[model samples]
Target: MILTLTPNPSVDRTIAVATLTRGVVQRATDSRMDPGGKGINVSRALAVNGTDTVAVLPVGGPQGQVMEDLLRAIALPVETVRISQAIRANVGIVEPDGTTTKVNEQGPRMSADEVAALLAAVDRAAAQGLEWLIGCGSLPPGLDGSFYADLVRRGHAVGAKVAIDSSGAPMAAAVAAGPDLIKPNDEELEELVGRRLATLGDVVEACRTLIAGGVGCVVVSLGGKGAVLVTADQVAHARATITDPLSTVGAGDSLLAGYLHALTHGADPATALRTGVAFGSAAVCLPGTEVPTPADVAKIDVEVVDPVDLDLPL
Candidate 1:
């Protein structure tokens, strides 16, 4: 069973407008709401793809109840820890031109005991037999940067491979702990290594540096340009076949889900990367956090290029 932990989950409200204007009232043409959070998205994607996934998160207040009801309505398997504060709500305004403006809440302020409770919940879930553990998204208020690191350590202790997708100090700390895999978009990758990445060579160098630092594998996702996969022995570049862009939101999460699913199913790294890029590209072709179907992935053209050894500054 795949277990996903979301420290800061939210209710996502998406509104569609013809255009966004500054300091003006714009009527929304349509509105929709769903579970919002990185780990939630990953679990949803996996579940849609026929993978058995359990979404473990902290929920509280009426808003949290609404979020849980929404997930249950969608038939998602969820395990939640009740907290004191209410969960957050994120708003996304999508323009007719396919541009999306997102406003995210910082989420609830978690207490130390609350954080420990969630970790304990993860332990319980692991004891029930977890094949893979995925720690994704940002740390909520009052939580330490090493939160995901702790999860990685615990997952490893339970003989489960851990995959992390996050940013800032949390991501850095998790990488230092050496998760089995990490999916960082181009921007996050640049931030992690403290440098500007302008080319594929730059991305490869960054991945190599992370691997040398003890990360098992690094997947750097480049919007439109596709993704780069780096391990100790090889670095492969996979490009998307479909070029027509719709929405770029949630593409990275979908990619991580696809890749993790493939890896868990015993596919090689190259095959997994190809599947990931395909899912990512397909996601961009759809609207709002919608993941690609296996049929969509099968139709995508993915080309894996030879590893390029570029001299880069560590």
Candidate 2:
């Protein structure tokens, strides 16, 4: 079983509009509300695919209640830590061609006691014998970059492998803690490495540096350019052709879910990378933040390349 912890969860409302103008009233073509945050998205995708997973997050106020109701409506297993303030509600505006403009709130400031309670909740969940503990999403106000680093230590103490999907200081600190895996998009990867990674070789070298620093593995998601996976012993690049996509939001989360799902089921790193790309490609074909089911993933074909073309521009 895998346990996911979302530091700043939200009620994500996505609106499909013909066009978005800065100062004009517009009618939405479609809309949807899903449980938001990286870890929550991963858990939701896993549960949809019949994986044993639990989502742990902080919920409070009316928005928090709505978030809880939505999770229950989907029959997702969740463990929520109550906070004093209402969690954030994020908005996404999508066009017909799958271009998304997102407006996200920073979320409420978590007090010292609330932060401790959140970590304690994660510890309790991890103690239930999870195979992996995934710490995801952004930190709420009042939390420092060391938050995910602290979680890595906590997960290791309980004998659970930890994976982190985040950016900025939180990600750097977590890297120093030597997580089992990290899922970062191309932009996030560049930020973490503090350099411009314009080619596939650049990405591999950056990941290798992290591995040298004790990170077990690094998975970099390059939108449309596919994804690259680097370990101490192997490097694989996987991509699937996706045409006329709907939305790109949460695609990376689905990729992480597919990769972990494969790993837990005994697949090798190369096969796992293919599965992740397939899942991500499938997600782009759907609307809003809707996750793809097993059927959706099965229809997509993935290609995994070894000795990747270093000159391929990202």
Candidate 3:
């Protein structure tokens, strides 16, 4: 089973409108609320695909209650740490053309005791054993950046591979600890290496640098251009075309989930990349943070090639 920990989970409310005009009244055409956080999304995607997975997160307040209700509605297995402060709620405004404007809360300021409780909760849940322990999402207020890095060491101690999907200082710290896998989008990759990546070569070079630093593998998602997989001795690029695209939220998480699902099922890295691209591509055709199931992904086709063309523009 795959275990996922989301440091800052949320009730993500997505409102769809024809056009977003500032200083004007607008009525939403549709809206949806989903459990939000990178790791939670990974678990949700996996669960829908018939994969064994568990989600671990902290919860509090009315919004936290809503989060729990949503997870229950989806029949997702979750282990929640009760925190004193309420969890965050995020808002996304999506236009018909697939333009999304987001307003995210900073999340509650967690106490030191609350932080310890969360760590303890993860330990308790992981005691049952898992194949992969994933630490993902942004650091909530008052949480240390080294949190995921600490999880990496803990996962290794328990004989489980660790994967991280986060950004900023927290991600940097986790990378220093050498996680088994990391799924960073092109922009996040640029932020980590502190440079602009204009071509596929730049992404490969940057991923190689991370592999040299002890990271087992790097998966870089390039949005519509597709994704790249880089390891110590392998490089592959995979892409899928999406017609009638809707929302991009949680697509990357679905990609990571697909890759992990395939890898755990004994698929090779290249095949896993193709599977990931298919899942992500399918996700884009759905609305409001919705994840696709096997039926939805099965219709998608992914083209994967090793020895990627470095000259390809990102």
**Candidates sorted on lDDT, descending:** 2, 3, 1
Q: Which candidate, 1 or 2, would have the higher TM-score against the true structure? A: 2
Off-target runs (Cα >4 Å) in candidate 2 are none
Q: Write the per-residue lDDT of candidate 2 for residues 200-232, one digit (tens) a residue.
A: 999999999999998999999999988999999
**TM-score of predicted structure 3:** 0.98
In candidate 3 the C-alpha lDDT for residue 52 amounts to 91
* Ten-residue region with minimum lDDT total, candidate 3: 299-308
lDDT of 3 by residue, 82-128 (tens): 88889999998998877788889989888888888888888888888
Cα lDDT tens digits for candidate 1, 1-314: 88999999989887878888989987988887878788888888888888888889999887899998989888988889999999998888887656889999999998878888888888877777888899999888889889889889989998999999999999999999999899999899999999998778888888899999999999988876778898999787788756566567788988888888888789999888988888888887777666788876777787776554344322
> Whole-model lDDT for model 2 versus the true structure?
0.92
The residue pairs found clashing in candidate 3 are: none
In model 2, pairs of residues that clash are: none
Q: What is the TM-score of each candidate against the true structure?
A: 0.93, 0.98, 0.98
Q: What is the C-alpha lDDT of each candidate?
A: 0.85, 0.92, 0.92
